[model samples]
Target: MHGLVNRALQEFVKDTYGADIWGEVRDQAALPFDEFESMLHYDIRLTKLTIDAASAVLHKDAASLLEDVGSWLVSNPAQESIRRLLRFGGTTFLDFLQSLEELPGRARMALPDLDMPEIVLQTDTPGRFKLEIRWALDGMGSVLLGALRGMADDYGALVVLEAEPGREGAEIVVIDLLDAQFAAGRTFELDAQMR
Candidate 1:
């Protein structure tokens, strides 16, 4: 697994549950180092161990913790860069939903070695979307679920989502857009100087 991915999991636990909890998780996972270097690579087994340790320490299932991690990446003030990157996909929630299909490509442009989950967005009906997420690693769709919720709030869109099992180890998420103008969303400026 990429260090960035593991580092993100570490950051999520530390930022949300407190550093002591994160330390316990790290020790339980038997991580050789205190911090995951964001640009390096590590054995995939380490990633699994960390997730398992975090789940045990936090008293939450791995899926739930990963979902929270996803939202934390987007909504946390310390991780505003991630929110900014996702917001750049659209001026509205619908537009952003459509752009999810291209997320893997966009991520590749920024970090060629970073392997992102393949996302397929299908809109067979207006105001409804089906997102199929497939990755070599499992549980990313759960994370996407949290990120989707955060994005909906970011654009002030009222959306309902459901996650179901998919064939060949894929995750299928059904999204229903209830309202496009539900509330006043957080303001975003295209130019840094404007903020």
Candidate 2:
């Protein structure tokens, strides 16, 4: 895992919960360092341990915690850099979803050592798509779900999201665009003709 992720998690806990709680979680996780440096690679196990410790201390399920973290990553002004990077993908919700396929490559360009999870987007039909995520670590599916929801919120698009079980180490997410016009606050009308 990248240190950026750990740092973000730390920030999320500290900012949301409190610095004292973060210290307790860090100690419970048996982490030696109080601060994680961005742009560095840390043991993935450390990240898992931190999450577990946080869950224990906060009395929240790991999935929900991760989801919150993901949402925070996109919605928090403190994370504007990450939000800007994501927004660069597109001007609309659909465009952003399509751009997810290239995010791994874009991330690699910025951090050569970072190995991002694979994201595949498949169109099921008009206004619907399937996102397949392949990751080595656990608990990221929920995070992705939250991130997608946050992105939808950012675009002001109303979307329905469903998660289906996939093969080991993979997650399949289904996205349905409920209303294309809702984001722009538009309405459609029909005209009838009589003979």
Candidate 3:
């Protein structure tokens, strides 16, 4: 699987710029799935990583970027619905992963600028939680996913920031799993995607 992924990556870059750039491009594009998903819980973890990556690379100041996005998401009406929906869903942390598809994105908009490998949320939960985010892009998407780590909530008060595959992904922000409003906060984080 690792070699297959490497070849696929080489093919991804090679088809775009010819085989001559394979070595340079491969070094960047060829990320193995296991390695890629290792940092994430396979649920919204990938989404957080993607959004964080985009936020970090698109904005100049990380603090300002998160604050701005967080504020915007909090105020946005549509995002408010997302948050409410997540809250109304259920109690388990896994329940929050359901509405990811409801994320605001027009069909014409580029998607999954950063393809997320399938993730398996490792936990003691009864049913194994797994998620896969796929994207179709006509170009134009954040190039920052190279910098965000996966996110996880222990169904407690400590939200775990899964380490990224590399040092470049998003940083571990805060882990507020204990807050009863944790699910609502996840909605706020997800709101970053709307921007």
The CA lDDT at 48 in model 3 is 40
> By TM-score, how accurate is candidate 1?
0.97
RMSD of 2: 8.6
Encode model 2's per-residue lDDT on 1-195: one tens digit a residue: 899888989999998989999999999999988878887888989998999999999999998898899889988878766767787787778888999999889988998778688898999999999988898677667778888888888777899987788787788888999864456521112221210
Residue lDDT tens for model 3, 1-195:
222222322333344446555443323433234223322333333334433443343444434433334333323454454234334434544454443333323211433332433222333344332222232211011111111112232223234332222222222222223343344324333344663
Error of 1 at 49 (Å): 0.9
How does candidate 1 score on lDDT?
Answer: 0.91
Q: TM-scores of all models?
A: 0.97, 0.90, 0.28
Instruction: For each candidate in the order shown, give its overall lDDT on alpha carbons.
Output: 0.91, 0.83, 0.32
Q: Which runs in model 1 stand beyond 4 Å of their true positions?
A: none
Candidate achieving higher lDDT, 1 or 3? 1
Tell me the tens digit of each residue's lDDT in model 1 across 1-195: 888899999999988889999899999999999988899999989999999999999899988998898889899999988899898899999989999998989888899988699999989699989999998788899899999999899999999988888889889989999998899989889985665
The alpha-carbon lDDT assigned to residue 13 of candidate 3 equals 33
Instruction: Give the range of the ten consecutive residues with the poorest summed lDDT in model 3.
Output: 138-147
How high is the lDDT of residue 56 in model 1? 97
